[model samples]
Target chain A: MLWEKEMRVPNTAVVDGKTYATVLGMVRDDRFIPLELVYKPKPGDNVVGIVTNVRHAGYSIELNLPYDGFISSKFTRVSFQQGDLIYGRVKFVDEVGNADITDAKRLPAGKIVDVPASKVPRIIGKKSSMLNVIRDGTGCSIFVGNNGYIWIGGKGNLPLALKTINFIVANAHKHGLTDKVAEYLNEHGGDVKVPPREEEKPPEEKSGLSEPAEETPEPAKEPETAEPSEPSEGEPVSEKEEKDAGSSEEEKQNPIMHSKSAGAAEESGEVKKKGIDIEEM
Target chain B: MEKPELIKDGKRLDGRTPKDLRPVKIEAGVLKEAQGSALVEWGGNKVLAGVYGPRECIPKHGADPYKAKLKIRYTMAPFCSKGEHSRSGPNRRSIEISKVIREAFEPVVLSSQFPRSQIEVYIEVVQAEGGTRVASLTAAAVALADAGIPMSDMVSAIAVGKINGQLVVDLGKDEDNYGESDVPMAVTHRDKQIVLMQMDGLLTREELAQNIDEAIEASEKVYELQADALKKSYEKEERGKLKL
Candidate 1:
């Protein structure tokens, strides 16, 4: 017979005049289980945290959320010191100039979900096509809010959307969807394309101008195009000679150069020129 | 009490001749949280030992700048007593046994490395038939090593008792009471150093010498078992690494 073990949740405790639920339990991932907190913590709540850094008076706390929240020591309890996780509340949003957050408990739970920072771009999709489907399918009011919080969960679709979001976030970098996150969403379930947000347009325009300016002025771009064309010109004649010498060198170096400098080729060329000067000297 | 018999044909009461020892099984690092721990079984006798240590000396007043203090405590459960004796702190016999055990281990342990720190060695006798003190001391040494305490050598001990006027390697409870003499010795197995020697009842000098030789031989066998237990612990640690 299989026995099910039930854990008892602790009685409600008052913290800062608010009743908060606390349950002592184990947190399990694919690997080991760690003793941790299980509670519903909203944003802007006065919570205790440990000071991970004293210079900036910064402190971090698990907050019973998927990720830890950070706060400055100025908002900390009196005995606050470096290396101390102390108590603090959100002292209002800096953007709104509301330094008083004494009654900010109603600000809602800060989004705790995180995609690996490396994988965030994939879930956002190239134009956010994948993200829209995820938002629509799960019916989660999805918002990749600034400050690394991916706000998720709304009404009935909360659970489904959360699962899909977690799956996408966990494997975003692995599937090469960092740039085209919308494609990943469509492949998973949600078929709708999210309208590209206006915020992404500025960076796209900047890149478009920089790309033409760099390539149009460079003689190096022509050599790359000509080399491949020559291979097709005198197929058998050049094949053997090229294979024994030029082709081997080109093939061996192309992948190394492409993988290392694909995103910053112009900067790499400048570095290479300086290196040659130093070597000659 | 009946006198134990020994035949010219080389047979004993339990059907083993002279120079024979009871079966010994040793396991190290048995307790998860202890720095060093072990459980040893010799025939019917069972002993468990836990070693905590080289930690900061508590109470501040107990701190010594020159050498590490070895606190050896040997305790027996109520069930291990002869009858329904009330459980209490260390008895006179246990105090004497602890003193001898501490001496046996001192020469083998590199205590100087942990200056001013205290190494607490706790030995619990779960079941006792005979030769419990010697068994417990040997088990403690094994545990201390398993806890990663550096010791010059492993300590091995055994008891030799005279039954029916003949020298025997290890004594069982029945033979011990009826026996004419009993001798317990702890030896450092690596260097063959005699760290502990104690006896009760009378024996001629030559006879005592012979018994000592026999006890040393039996201890060497016990030392081999100790090494085997250490090897098994290392193998278990290796398996844990693979899982990680």
Candidate 2:
């Protein structure tokens, strides 16, 4: 009894209140036809169709809405073997179920123009400041490729946002980033740019001890040594002059006696007065 | 499984006369997350190993100031078994294999550079046809390189067996059980220094020397493949960074 065909059918069909049936014969294909070959169908579109005959080039999907659709191998990124049941969106439909299938669930708006790879560093700015500014102003998701391919997409004001990005990238090196972006938006009629202000420097008034206390000791020591030696030589000069004849006798015995008067005269102001008196004589 | 006869048309299985080795293919840094990893396939046997670290020693008590400790664990996965699942953990056979692997790598690895640290080597036997321990040792050396660990030279290991009273290189499971003797040896592919060596069963002195010579030749071929794999992984990493 368990081996009967009826028992097998029930087991296959009954699962969680959903009934499934094996295709005894080919059902009518109800898939959609893509309007443009490159364009993908929008998301949440129902794909209902019967594949009539699978071929090497593409699958001929027939829809109940009278549109005969073709799902080409070129349109799909995934490889399909024979007897594969492909699920895709129906882009278009006529009365006769003739349709064209497309794997592209959604079409992206505004593709990136090829920019030079070297220019990317300038466009992105240091730490991505340029990119951050564009994203905040435009409300768009921008992806920049290393090879200079940029992809930008979002809902409203997409064209305007794209134009702004292009302008920013073009004039990046000339005028610098923050100032140029601000000037461009003001001229072209977009959002206004807020400039940051400069910081003020602190005051540099002088304190009391500018010269420093440690340096004062050096100048005072030189004068004290010069004054003490001069007075001692002046007192010895009168005695030496009175004993001049005796001094020559002393000089023969002691060589120290001859130079004592000359030493005393040089230490006192008498040496300058004696030179003036010699010039008069 | 019935064992294949050692001698047929005066040659062993896979049509090699005595002293022929199984083909070896080695690739390093197969796993991106691991510090060092390698996948080595010696004939039908496939083995992979990952080297974790010369990192801070765990359990604190395991730290030794004398030399850098090597924590090695060799394990065979369930799929490696042909029959029922074998008991897991450090079995006597696995422990012996671990000991042999540790000793084989000791000379080649500059352990003194990493004092008070531990290097963890995890060898996984992906497919067990035969000569897994030898394959594991060879793969582990490549894994250590992939992890960027400094080594004196690459360790290359090969299993040489005596079949039909004649020495052969790289015995399969059938040839291993019926073969007369097996000597698994590891050597530094750069300087030809013997790091790890062991023989089981029986062999003459002349036969053992011949086996060692044949093993060294086979290991050099494996070393070339390991170098190529490491080069490819580094190139791939450079490409990934360029994309971002």
Candidate 3:
């Protein structure tokens, strides 16, 4: 049967004289099953957004959320055309869920897939260890958004990486998810190794949520390792993979590596305090 | 034209009873490029529906600032009909069906959710026995759902008609050519809200009410079949999961 409108049983909140139907545990209803997942972005969170609408002033980005977030004019210095993928930080998130972003860097060539929004934390895993395993195994540069959109970029093991990641997303509700993903990665990830991440120095800090991508660079990108993207072939990168590296000029600006080049322990503590790891909501 | 025998011993021309619907087979996710696609075979009718976009709206000016605009094309193949030799282009009948079908869907779709975008549904009648619109509407809803377009509910449809002075459900080609009346109807499967209703030929006021009521109830079966087709699409992915 088509679902009738749910009975609003008194649980609501009034913010600025506007009342919203807010249920506990992010439940659609206490009486009925949950049908939709609403993603809320906190400050310092990383999101991969697709540029949905563009104008001379700025752009509107779709973050797998219902409403599009705006990247205003001043931040438009880094030119982003419509349909470009932006690896941005959530700068200003309001009670009404509207967002204003800053330092919106673009993601290079990659395949993007969306999973159920609530399943996002499971993909990130505990302290991002599951994410590390997937990244290390496949030799793909991976970035996951709080909005449940995942971007994977690299060479050779793409299709297999996509299959394994989607599996984790699908079966996340089940327990022992990390172990299963690790096992799958170990068994099918092949013999290649990920090169260490290069922590190029950061530009002057701009705002509170400046450079979450850099602050939380994946463990796969280390400076000491010899070029993480290629383990087997010492050949030139494909045109597509090369386009993914951003303009060579911007490489000096170094968008994704933070000033804090210490190590993984620092990365784990910072992300945890930020309350990034997904929890059932 | 000879009025072919439509019912004998309370059986339809296809040897089914008046209340018996034609065998219908629906499959979802049939086309690769379309966001969602479905093919439905009801009786002798074959209808394929493909849904694309909620992407960008084209022609610039046609883009609605408040809601997604709908672009619908309901067409019949030149050789879809038997003996009569149907034409390839849009006719008065197809145009009317297209308009009503669009109106039927616009109410339930939450188009305002995707502003300045266009969602297009193309329904192609590959084989036409009768009740092409009903079959098309059924397939279109499945394709739209499979496309992950947000909707209030999926709609299912069927045709009710009078054949040989007896009320019948889902008329066959020969039965329709010889039948007295055809009433095509669709309802929101979740709310049972009547979305599309049209009558042709003639029916008593009492027969019209009764047939419309009966057809709505009979649509429950069609709704179940539609759900089964969508579920079957995901079932095929299990092997892909296990293989990994």
Candidate 4:
């Protein structure tokens, strides 16, 4: 019932009392499932890809999706060879999941980590919390693709970063994952600094219990406006209509009374003016 | 071969009652290279199903513009059966089984979600009993779900037949070989809509209809096993991560 108000999206289903995922994924809010089981490309995605083929006009980039991505020669400032690693942003996505990438640059010699595209958000964490811990603690410069490919470079601890990422992917569906990941990172000799998670919004919002409280006032107001419109439309009056009809009738009367009083005031003023004019005559 | 006792009293050759199904074990994500893979052991049948794509359709010409094409290959190994060595390759029987399996899955798989793509399912019968087609389909459905292919609902299958004049669910190889009639059926458990149904022998109209209901009823158990297997695979990985 809590997820019905907030987390219910395309890939989620409600069975009995619990929300179940229809796709092969952790029980995450459907909105956060930008990367589906198969990565469907969206515009403005920062992507890491392997350049599989370099044509005269463009490069065919493999982003781990079913369809390969194409980067036109005009979009890139420098030429890329086959097998070169490139990091870019998705510029366009067609009706199918094919992507046209832009702003691509060759990445340095480093390891490319592949994860399930759906788990990309977990690796990134809330507000990049996990990413910052991995980056700051291991001192690795990391570039993450929404398509589940991660590029790690610079002189940071790559193994630690990878282990932390793997751990995040494994337990992506668990609650309080950030703290557990922080503990794991610290235990593994990575000097990752974990920002205090307590500063974040409390557990009520995370558990989604607080959402209905925010939502209750919304439905209460809808019935009030709907009550007057129903009678005017000559539709059958239901129980809800009958319930709010009293307040709606009062609201209707107040507006009519204001108009009637204003009309009376104008008439009385005109009569007084006429009386004054006749007296003068 | 002499006619063996297919059923005695209320039990079949495998010592299962008329309503009992063979033990079904399923494991998901078994192959690293496949997008999704599953192994299903139903009775003596060992079926491995692997899924690839919603990727670009090969040969360009075979691609469907509006929906992803489903290519299914249901094959059995040469040494899968008991008697003589079976020949490997797409024989007429495997080809027919492949088509029916594909048709069974077509309505459930949300192929329209991916245009100009193809999802290939390879169901290899490592060992065969009587109900390899149903077992392969059971595994393929799991593999598709494990691969994250969008499906409206999980499809499950079972075989039912009249063995020794007694209606039984999930016929064994000997029972199927000697039974008067056999019906292999696949159904979407949520709606009980029969996606695949085949009859191999004669039956009364009432018996045919009743066997369909029996197969649909038996498929619910198969559906539960598939769901549990898919979840257990992930749960095992999660537990391993926690141990770390």
Best by DockQ: 4
Model 3 Cα lDDT, one tens digit per residue, B130-224: 88999999999888766656565568899998988888888777767778998899987645789999888899999998898889888988987
Candidate 4 pairs with clashing backbones:
A137-A192
Candidate 4 per-residue lDDT, tens place, A210-246, comes to 2222322222221111111221111111112223323
On the 0 to 100 scale, the lDDT of residue B26 in model 2 is 78
lDDT for B243 in candidate 2 is 16
lDDT for predicted candidate 3 compared with the true structure: 0.63
**How well does each candidate superpose onto the true structure, as a TM-score?**
0.47, 0.46, 0.67, 0.78
Clash count of each predicted structure? 17, 23, 6, 1
- Candidate 2 CAPRI classification by DockQ: incorrect
Q: State residue B81's C-alpha deviation in candidate 4, in Å.
A: 2.4
Lowest summed lDDT over 10 consecutive residues: which window, candidate 4 chain B? Answer: B235-244
Model 1, A281: alpha-carbon shift in Å?
54
User: Residue B169 error for model 4, in Å?
Assistant: 0.6
Error of 1 at A257 (Å): 53
Ranking by lDDT: 4, 3, 2, 1
TM-score of 3: 0.67
What is candidate 2's lDDT per residue for B1-244, written digit by digit as tens?
5545788877777887666667777776676556567898888878889887666578667866644678889988778869443765677788899988998877655454455567889998878888999899988877876554545456778788787777788888777888888888887764577877888889988888888888889777666666555544432322111111
Best by lDDT: 4
Candidate 2 Cα errors over 4 Å, as ranges = A1-281, B1-4, B83-85, B237-244
Candidate numbers sorted by TM-score from highest down: 4, 3, 1, 2
